[model samples]
Target: MGPLDRIEELIAYVEAAKAVPMSRACRVDRGELIAMLEELQAELPADIRRSEVMLAERDKIISAGEKEAERIIAEGEGEHARLVSQHEITVSAEHEASRIIGEAREEAQRLRDEVDEYVDTTLANFEQFLQRAVSGVERGRDKMHALREIGTFNPPEQEESEEKPLPQF
Candidate 1:
């Protein structure tokens, strides 16, 4: 029987013993009690050893579980850090892109303004040139009309030996 069963038998044996006439004691067989006690003593060490082995196994299981938990926590923290770093990089990149785009837009607008101003100035200069040309042509016609009225509308013929070039506007 196990130690507990043996202990229960010992209790029963003590309870079933005859009571003394005037004392609060009982009449238990000494030999029987001693034998039971010896048996209990013999079984205790083996039981204690088994309990110790179970406790060691429990400790090993707990240690492994604690190590696994620590590893998982560390891995999770690393992943979180990586994700945060990636997010920061993305935010920085977006801001940089926005700044670059803004600068490019401003540059494009400046170039367009410069081109418009150049075209306007060029057109104004061309208009002035055209006006001067028209004035020259009108003055030449007036001179011709006056000459015709005075009866001297003849254009001079150039001699082949001393040819002269016509006047240029």
Candidate 2:
């Protein structure tokens, strides 16, 4: 029989026992009660051992779950750190690229200004040289006209003493 049934039987036995007159004491067979107690004791250890085993299994499962939770939290933290680092690197790279582009534009503008200055200086010098050449040509033309008007422009005649004879081939 189960422990509960044995306990009920013990309760019945005590209730049917003889009561002493005017006292809270009762008379029962000691040998029979001892035998019943021995049976209960024999049944108790197997049930207690099963309960202990179940409690141990529950503790093991709880420990494993806690360990898994810790691992997942650590992995999440590592991923967060890596993403933050990548974002910082991207932001730094963007700023550096902007700085480089700004410097390149400034340098390009400076070069353009230098080229324009050189071109303007060269054109001015060429204009001055052309003006001087035209002025010299005009002066020569004026001298020729003056000589013609003064009748001093003459065609030279070759004298016989100064002429050279042609060579016969």
Candidate 3:
């Protein structure tokens, strides 16, 4: 299950557990609780890794777009130079070169604009996803903290089970 789901499940488990007599703590199956916690721990790192991969991909895409834009601009400049040199050094030839250069610049600008728009849109969507993911994690964290502060569970008085150390982040 997802991190949010795991958090909700944990909350539900806590809510459904029996409350200890004369105490705020509930009696949850230690093994089950530990399992749920392990699941949650596993899920969180995957989400973080996914976000990191996406950010890296976003950077690569933006870089590629920029390189493509520069290459187009350079090609345009080269074409302009070639056209100018091929014709006799006349006013019309210079004018044609100027026109070519202008068109090249306009085309390059248009391409850059397109790339920018695409990158912005993509990044915006990714940002929204990341925001939602972060918010969900934060909410889960708050809930966990609240549960901890309240001391969610206490062992039964009659039966003492060996407590195992939980894995640390």
Candidate 4:
């Protein structure tokens, strides 16, 4: 029998013993009780060793679980760091693109202003040249009318060699 069963049997035997007269005591066989106690003592060490082995096994399992948890935590940390780095790179790329776009816009504006100034200056120069040419033509007409009134004007035919070629643009 196991220690527990033996202990129960011992208790039953003690309870079933005859009561002593005029005393809160019972008559138990000393030898039987002693034998039962000795047997219990003999069984205790083996039970204790089994308990110790079981406790050691539980500790080992707990240690393994703790290691696994640490490994998983480390992996999570690595993944988090990688994601953070990737996010930073993406943000940096976006910032660089924005900077480049801003610079391009500024350059385009500057070029546009330069082109507008160039066109305005060219038009002003062309207008001045046309005004001067118109004035020259008016002066020549006045001289021709004065000559006709003085009776010295002649509508002479021009020779091909006398003709001036038009100016190239």
Candidate 5:
């Protein structure tokens, strides 16, 4: 078969020798096996050297592929980092915007509360003024009615009177 198949078969044969018990018909010569293994060792290196350039080129190709794989992985990692950073920046911007909006809503609510308080105070003041005006109008009407009954609304003449001093507390 192929060279690897032959090598495997040979290793099996060598291993099988250890399992078989020595008998009259199973005697093996160590000298022949050692001579064959020595001959194989001597020729194997020369055969391997014949293809040294091809092996070197194959190794170079494998090394280049490994480097390319590393480059691709690094690029993927960088891209992932960039996307993560961008996501963080977007989230930060959204947070800032939300904070500003919240602050504005709070300020608007506060202003609305102040306006409501002011309106309530102003309405109270107006109601008080209206009550005083109605009372004053009623007093004027009563005075007119009294004047009609007396048939006059005459005033007293001014007189020079001495002013009295009050006691201090």
Candidate 6:
């Protein structure tokens, strides 16, 4: 039995025993005292067994609930970790795309600078060629004037080089 019930049982036994004492103070019949003790002994074991069953049932329910709670907690933690991993992969992809775009832009700028340099060099070379052409025309004019003054200016009709005829000044 529980502690309180054990105490009560003990007290009852003490009372019955005291009553049965063939003493002057608390006199009681012997047969009645024997009956009381016998009844108490029989009832105590049943009471103790009932209390043990109740405790066992309570413990079983508590342990089952605890196992269910642990399963739910483990599932929630797994879901959280999966979401975090997916987010990290997404962020990494975005970072890589940004880096590649930046590199492409830098390469485009480098090519543009090279094109600008080439164009400037070509224009300078074309300008020098035009100046040389004008100088050659002036020299040809001076040669034609001297030949006319001497009355001895006769050019061969055909030239070996495949070129347009120089203008006679």
Count of backbone clashes, every candidate in sequence: 0, 0, 0, 0, 0, 0
lDDT of 3 by residue, 1-169 (tens): 6766776787788788887567665666767877887887787677667656766765676567667666665765666677677656555656765676576567656766776676677667667765665675575456555557557455568876789999899
Per-residue lDDT of 74-115 in model 6, one digit per residue for the tens? Answer: 554554455456865765555554555455455545544554
Which pairs clash (backbone N, Cα, C closer than 3 Å) in model 4?
Answer: none
| 1-169 per-residue lDDT for model 2 (tens digits) | 8665666666677668777555444566767866876786687676556555655655565555556555554554554455556865765555554555555455545555655565556556655644554454454345334434444434487666966799999
Q: Which one wins by lDDT: 1 or 5?
A: 1
lDDT of 1 by residue, 1-169 (tens): 8665666666677668777555445566667776876786687677557545655655565555556555555554555555556865756555554555555455545555665565556556655644554454444335334434434334488766866798899
Order of candidate numbers by lDDT, starting with the best: 3, 1, 2, 4, 5, 6
lDDT of each structure? 0.58, 0.57, 0.67, 0.57, 0.49, 0.49
Best lDDT among the predictions, by candidate number: 3
Write down the worst ten-residue block by lDDT for model 1. 144-153
Question: Which lDDT tens digits does candidate 5 get at residues 38-123?
Answer: 55446545544545554465456555555655555555455555555676576655555455555545654555566556555655
lDDT of 6: 0.49
RMSD of each: 65.4, 66.6, 13.0, 64.6, 59.1, 64.8
- The reply for model 2, stretches above 4 Å from the true place, is 17-29, 88-169
- 58-82 in candidate 4: lDDT tens per residue? 5565555556555555555555555
Report how far off residue 26 is in candidate 2 (Å): 6.1
Q: Any runs in candidate 1 off by more than 4 Å, and if so which?
A: 15-29, 88-169
Return the lDDT, model 1, position 109: 53
Model 6 segments beyond 4 Å from truth? 1-23, 88-169
Could you tell me how far off, in angstroms, the CA of residue 135 lies in candidate 2 after the best superposition?
99
Q: Is candidate 2 or candidate 6 better by TM-score?
A: 2
79: Cα error in model 6, Å: 1.6
State model 2's lDDT: 0.57
